[model samples]
Target: MSIRIWGRPTSARTQKVLLALAELGLPFELTLASGTMGAHGHVAKGNEAFGVVDTPDYRAMNPNGTVPTILDDGFVLWESNAILQYLAMKYDPDRFYGSDIGRFASAARWIMWENNELIPPMHNLVKHTIRLPEDQRDPEIAAASRAALGRAWGIVDTQLSRTRHIASDSWSYGDIPMTIRVHRWALLAGVDALSPTLARYYAEVSARPSFDAIRDPAMHLAG
Candidate 1:
């Protein structure tokens, strides 16, 4: 049976899963759940209209009630990064995931850094720019988040200067998380203010077929 992906296309997490599936040449089916589309087949804005994420059935599958839950045959999983690693390891281990301890650690390091240091600011920036209405958007928050993201990107730029990719000279699970977030960033205003090194890296990764298959700006904001 084909892998069934449960989540909306606009979700960053869901996009990650889709990217991984495409990269691994795996077949899958998409079920729009979350945001405008609820898991129970209801079409409405916000989580309340459908409350799929809060429903007992969804909570049973994913305690967090988050988007992008994958059912691979009988095996079920959530958490976008974990799902990406699982798909890579199961379908295309040698190429997609890092096998060596050093490589794995390097990739893991970026994932941690991204989640801890980078995502907060990035999420805030996205929320301010796209998620929030122009009248309600907080310029202070956006400026602060943008500044923080600039600092984070500087670190990434320095790292990229030393290696062709974020984790190393080659692509690994490390690039996946950053790729999704970075692409979204580029769509926002003031992208040119970002470091050239980061721009090059984004362009290079964006050129990949897997990324092309899953890239979607519509997923970032809105229900």
Candidate 2:
């Protein structure tokens, strides 16, 4: 399969799919489109097509003009979590997605929870705390987002205390999205404490080969 991912490596959404690819040992080309390099240019707007081509020509491929889009053997797909699920089911279905129906549903449940519960608050916190200039940042919004994040983290911590992984005893696509969010949590301000279970889980996931390859502390808001 000819696989290509378009987006900056530092993007949490991009990291989700990339981490899944790495776990599955899938070889693909990565085209950087977002961040300081700004590979896609100003035409795309708002970090769109940063890693992928957003030129008038490339827009024909993905009209939404988003980063972290993928083209696999003529199958074009966007949305980070969907891409992760596709990769797992297409390549290493038995392992990453699991073979049993109950296990697969559980894995899907956590992935959905990450998208719904974790990503929004995490994104808000990162944007207000790190992405925005201090003069422009809103402390009230950041505070509210951080509180929501604490609740989300607490839920994950309780789950981790019971199970080795989010869904199953082994790693699965469910872990990818939240693992990327954990990077933002570690960098964002106002986080005085992290649950011990979460800390241990972060350590284990951070040590993965995929995490080592793409995790970028330099991309944090202070930068």
Off by over 4 Å in 2: 34-54, 189-192, 220-223
Taken over the whole model, the C-alpha lDDT of each candidate is 0.76, 0.73
Question: TM-score for all predictions?
Answer: 0.87, 0.85
The most accurate candidate by lDDT is 1
Residue 191, model 2: Cα distance from true site in angstroms: 9.3
Clashes of each: 2, 5
Residue 152 C-alpha lDDT in model 2: 86
Per-residue CA lDDT of candidate 2, range 61-151, in tens?
A: 6677666788999898988777877887888878775766777788889988988998887777766766555676789988998789878
TM-score of 2: 0.85
Best-matching candidate per TM-score: 1
lDDT of 1 at 22: 77
